[model samples]
Structures are given as structure tokens and as C-alpha cells.
Target: MYLFLSDFHFGLGTPEAQARRRQDFFACLDHYADRLEALCINGDLFDFWFEWKRVILKDHFSILCKLKGIADRGAAIHYLAGNHDFALSRFLQDEIGAQIHRDEHVFETGGRRFYLQHGDGLAPADWGYRLLKRLFRSRFNQKLYSLLHPDFALEFAHLCSRTSRNHSSRRWDVDGWAYREAARAKIHQGFDYVIYSHTHEPLLEPLGRGVYVNTGDWLKHNSYAVWEDGVMTLKYWGMPWMERSQEEGYSKRQVGTG
Candidate 1:
């Protein structure tokens, strides 16, 4: 099974809430411990992250350790650096056994093709945001910003968290068209499925011969999509995996197999 999750936005909420989110997501990982083929954290796993050559945020040690633990378990883990996290140096690649992805990645499972991305740096209409992303991702800008002391860096990360993404999560309005069009653009890629995470809208749209899936944010929907066999099913987390059958009077969440 290929599991996809994103938009963790760690360190942006109350300490308890933040930790719980991380724990819940990782606990979800434990369920996949035996069967998981690939674990894809699409993006935004960290709301504010700037990794100096020698420094990783001290606060995230436990979080990173958890991920490392999963990686240590032997399932191939892939992380697509989101707009929030770009400077993925040796800290993750060398220290942890994760195959980090900055742009896109292609992999195969169950005789099906998968195209994966964070989906933040796409969307042509969002030119202004894209410009900012470029600036953040620029090598020169990264070096310049790295000059600040760790104290100031922590403070800056906190400020940005309070003023930016956390403030936006309260509003779950989604860009339905942008994702649809983006998915449509990839219909001819010979891929069976295209998956992304930035939009936070739990969706599955069948476009011609291919399928598009958005794993929705953890904040609002508490939902995620699961692909088993040749089928994809979306189910709310923290609930029974199966829902009651309408006709058979039995619990099940099995929607269908694609």
C-alpha cells in the first residue's frame, strides 16, 4: 500500500494540540507498519523549517525521531518538501533513511503508476505566492537567512506561524478549480493516479482515464484517502474503518475498488 499524507504544520498550534497532531499522524503510521510499501508525506510537514548545515530545530527532535523510526523500520519513506520546508540538507537524507523529494517522484505498485507532488508551487493564477516561493527556495536567500542566530530564527518561525498558515487553517475554503485543472493537465502522463496535498480539500475526481486525489488537511476534515488492491477509498480518521452497510446491516467503510 502507498500511503499519502501532508500539511502537518507542526509547531503552529498550542503545544498540546501540536503534539497530538503529530502523535496521531504517527500512530496512523503504526497501523501501516506491516503493509505499507511507501509512505509519502506530500508536504507542509513543518510550518516553519530552515535547516542550517549543522542545525535542525531543536523542538522537532522528537518529531524527526518518530519519522526516522518509521524509516528505520524499512518501508521506503518519501517526503516532498512543501513551500514551508525546502532546505532539506543532509539532516534528513543522511541522518534519516528517507528518500526526500523536492519536485516530483515516480514510483510503481500493484501494476499502477503514481505521480506525487506537494502541489503548492503549482497554480499559474497564484503568481504572487509562486514568486515568494521562489524567493524562499533560492540558494542566495537561503544563505542570507541562515546568517541569523538560532534564537532569532526560532522567533521568526514563530512569528510566521502565527501570522500566516495557522491563521489560514481556520478557513477551509478550497480552490476546487485550480486542482481540477492541474489534474486535468496530467491526464496524458500515462499515470493511473495523481496525488497532491496542499489544497486541503478531500476530493477524488475522475478525469477521463486517470484519477486525482486530495488528502485534505488534518485540521478540519480529519479525513484521508486509502488505496487498497486496485481501489481507492476515503475515510474519516479516528473512526471505525468500516461503516454500517446500508442493506446488510453491517459496519463497513469500503466505498469501492477502482
Candidate 2:
């Protein structure tokens, strides 16, 4: 069984809220840890994450330990970089045995081919964001930013993340056409499922012969997805199961079993 989640944006909320959400997230992990074949974090686990040589973000320490414990229990950990948390490096890999993917991850599991991405730059009209992504991801720029004190850098990054998030919310299209189109293109290329999570809206739409899933975010929906026995289903944090439909239209029915 594979569990997929995204867009926690851990540092975006108040300290008390963040702690409560973190504990709930930890409980979900603990519940599923022993049965999971892999735990895939699709993106934006942090609001902003940048690690200096000797300074790492301590806010993520407890969750990181929980993830490491899951890894130690025999589930592979796959952390895909999201727009907000794109500064990820080797710390997760070294400490939690995580496989960090910068943009997308392609894998075969349960006899199915899955394509996973954070759904950031897939839209052609998002040229400005694409350019900014390049600038922020430049190795030289990262090196220069790393020269600043970690405390100041993190504070600035968090402020920027908040502003950017506000701006994005104002302009975000709830229909999510770009993500659906992207999934359509990938499904034509032979993937059984295309998963994404930047829009923060949960979706499970059938496109051609394959399916498209957006794992949604922990902020409002607390949604996730699971792939098991050759089928994938989107679920809420407290739901045990959501039955999948094969028809063009998808409908979710909650069940009582894992």
C-alpha cells in the first residue's frame, strides 16, 4: 500500500495550530506506518525550507523524526519538492532515508505506472512563475542566499511565502483546468495515474483510460490519497476508505475498513 499527501505548509500557521496539525499528521502516520509499502509526500511539506551547512529548520524536527521512524519500520520515503519547499537538499535523504525528487517522480507500483508532480510549472500561461522559479533555483543564488544568517533568511522566506500565497489565492482558478490538461497529456503517454497537489483542491477525475488525482492540502481539507491493490483512492485524514468508481464520472463512498 502507498500513502500520498501534500501541501502541509507547516510553518504558515500559528505555533499552536501548527503543533496541533503536526500531532494529527503524526497520528495518521503512526496508524498507517506498519502497513504502508511507501509514504509519498507529494510537495510543500514546509512553507519554506532551506538548510545551511550547520543550521537546519528546527520546526520540522518532530515530523522529520516521525518520518524517519516510518522509514526505519521498512517503508520507502519519497519526498517530492513543491513550489514552497523547493530548497530541499540532502538533510532529509541523510536523516530519514528519503528519496527527494526535485520536480516529478515516475514509478511502478502494484503493476501500475504512476506520474507524480507538484503541478507548479505545468501551465503555459504561468510564464512569470516559471521565470521566478528559475531565478530562485539558481545554484549561484542559493549559494548567495545561504551566506545570510539562517534566522534572518528563514524569517524573510516565511514572509515571502505568506505574501505569495495570498496573491495566489486571489488568482487561483478552482476549476484547475491546467492540471487536468497536464494529466490528460500524461495519461495519453501510458501512465495509469497522474497525481498532483498545488491547487489545494482535491480531485479525482477520469481522463481517457487513466485517472488524475490531486491529493489536496492539510490546511483546509486534510486530504490524502492511497494506492493499493492496483487502485488509487482519494481520502480525508479521518476516513478509513473511499471506494473508487470506474465510470467517467467519479463518486466517493466512505467505507469502514482500511
| Local distance difference test, each candidate | 0.71, 0.82
Leading candidate by TM-score: 2
Question: In model 2, what are the clashing residue pairs, if there are any?
Answer: none
Tens-digit lDDT string for candidate 1 (21-70): 87788778888788887778888788878788677898788888988888
- State each model's C-alpha RMSD to the native: 5.1, 3.3
Q: Give candidate 2's TM-score.
A: 0.91
Clash total of candidate 1: 6
Measured by lDDT, the strongest candidate is 2
Name the lDDT of candidate 1: 0.71
Give per-residue CA lDDT, model 2, range 1-258, as digits (tens). 899899999988899989878987998788787789999999999989898988898878888888888999999999999889899988999988999999899998667899999987666666667777888789999999999998889878977677556444324435677888889999999999999998887778888899998888888777888877777777777654443433426742323333
Against the true structure, candidate 1 reaches a TM-score of 0.86
